[model samples]
Target: MRKIYITLMLVVGFSAVGIAQEINWLTLEEAVKLQKKNPKKIMMDMYTNWCGPCKMLDKNTFQNKDVADYVNKYFYAVKFNAEGNDVVNFNGKTYTNPNYNPAKANNRNSGHELARYFSVRSYPTIIYLAEDGSLLAPVIGYQTPQQLELYLKLFKNNDHAAFKTQQDFQAYAQAFKPEFKN
Candidate 1:
């Protein structure tokens, strides 16, 4: 009986440790608010329910300890559903897709005005915004943990504005290495 009790205590202790290490995800409002106080850029993972790559990003890249640590440190991380009931307030107005028909299930939304505002043409678009609520850039598609790190650093350091062309970005990326470990 003592051996069994010890085993149970060990299991409970390890479970608590694992839960404590989990990433703390912030809501859109909370993230925006934090950005205002902390002076960090916003990195929003704009995802749709039907997006496969979005799920992969959540499971793979975002799950990596390095990626999580970097994002938690430098960004006001936000996960926004491209088709959801949440009303977003930006630039003195509220935006929502009241016409969203989730029943169709063919990867269609009621047409979020915010998505249109950002010109988001695809699923899983990662939108980066400056600390002052200015548009930075929206990158669409899947990116590995390492690849995502480059953009995180790029926008965090205001390098996006310096590199006006893809060639310039490529050159910079080639020469870049993370100054601090995640």
Candidate 2:
């Protein structure tokens, strides 16, 4: 009877842990539409199915509880497939993957038109956008949770706008303290 009680408690504990680790991901259009009522920055995760680092970014950083909770609170998260065939509309323009080959759906394919529009050159690029949907910057490559916190807080708090020079940005970086845990 005691073993059954302990097993039930373990299940409840694991279920609660799972609930806190999810970032509410939305489509680009959905996030933009929602911004009208509730203005929040957008953090777009641009990835491809074939990219190894993209998968790592998901399993390691995005899944981290601190990253998920902070993103859910301050930004709209977007998961966009850089090479997938999806028709996306943004900034009064419609974009599609005209060169998408279904045969290469799970392999290397041409870049989507939206990915090209944003000038995303590599996989696992986290593109930060303003609350009104304007582009801020692209953080390229895989970053751990603590490494990503710098950009997240800077953009969320509008701290990046204070930089008038490279040295200013360097100074900000030199004094920056990351709050996210590894």
Candidate 3:
């Protein structure tokens, strides 16, 4: 009975060791700082409090175990409030939401200068950055786990550079098979 109990506990502990239920999200600055020593792509979720799709993305897509695990392995995840009043420093520049209204924190607030710098006009945008903290691209709106796997693989592998035309991307998208569970 003692051996059985010890074996069971060991199995459970080992299985849980590599599985990720939640993403370890960091600030953009933190991610960038870590990138200097350990280079990995940064995936930023640009969201606002008022955006319904942003909430859904958090609940449905980001909550998936496979998505969380993949992100934790290949990228440094940053959850940034696109309309919040957080001061940010990036690429030798400082950014802030100078027009942010405290009363409208839950409603429509002023856009952050960082969001403007990234040209994020929509909520729930997934902004991908290179390992060196350079901008890769922005995937706008909500995405399911399976749907998001394509972009995750595309940027992680730097395959987006091969697409020289819209038709090229369309062809690639058509042939792509998602391995992530929904």
**For model 3, how does the per-residue alpha-carbon lDDT over 47-122 read when each residue is reduced to its tens digit?**
9999999999998889889999999999999999999999899988999999999999999999999999999999
Q: Give the poorly placed runs of model 2, Cα more than 4 Å off.
A: 1-20
Each model's number of backbone clashes? 2, 0, 0
Model 3's alpha-carbon lDDT is 0.93
Predicted candidate 2 versus true structure: per-residue lDDT over 1-182, tens digit per residue: 99999999999998876744889999999999999999999999999999999999999999899999999999999999999999999989999999899999999999999999999999989999998788999999999998899889989999999999989878988899988876
- The CA lDDT of each predicted structure is 0.80, 0.93, 0.93
**Sort by TM-score, top down from the best:** 2, 3, 1
lDDT of 2 at 160: 93
Q: Is candidate 1 or candidate 2 better by lDDT?
A: 2
List the pairs of residues colliding in candidate 2: none
Error of 1 at 8 (Å): 5.5
Segments of candidate 1 deviating more than 4 angstroms: 1-22, 102-107, 178-182
| Highest-TM-score candidate | 2
* RMSD (Cα, Å) of model 2: 2.3
Candidate 1 backbone collisions, by pair: 99-110, 100-110
Using TM-score as the measure, name the better of candidate 1 and candidate 2: 2
Model 3 worst lDDT window (10 residues): 14-23
Q: Flag clash pairs in model 3.
A: none
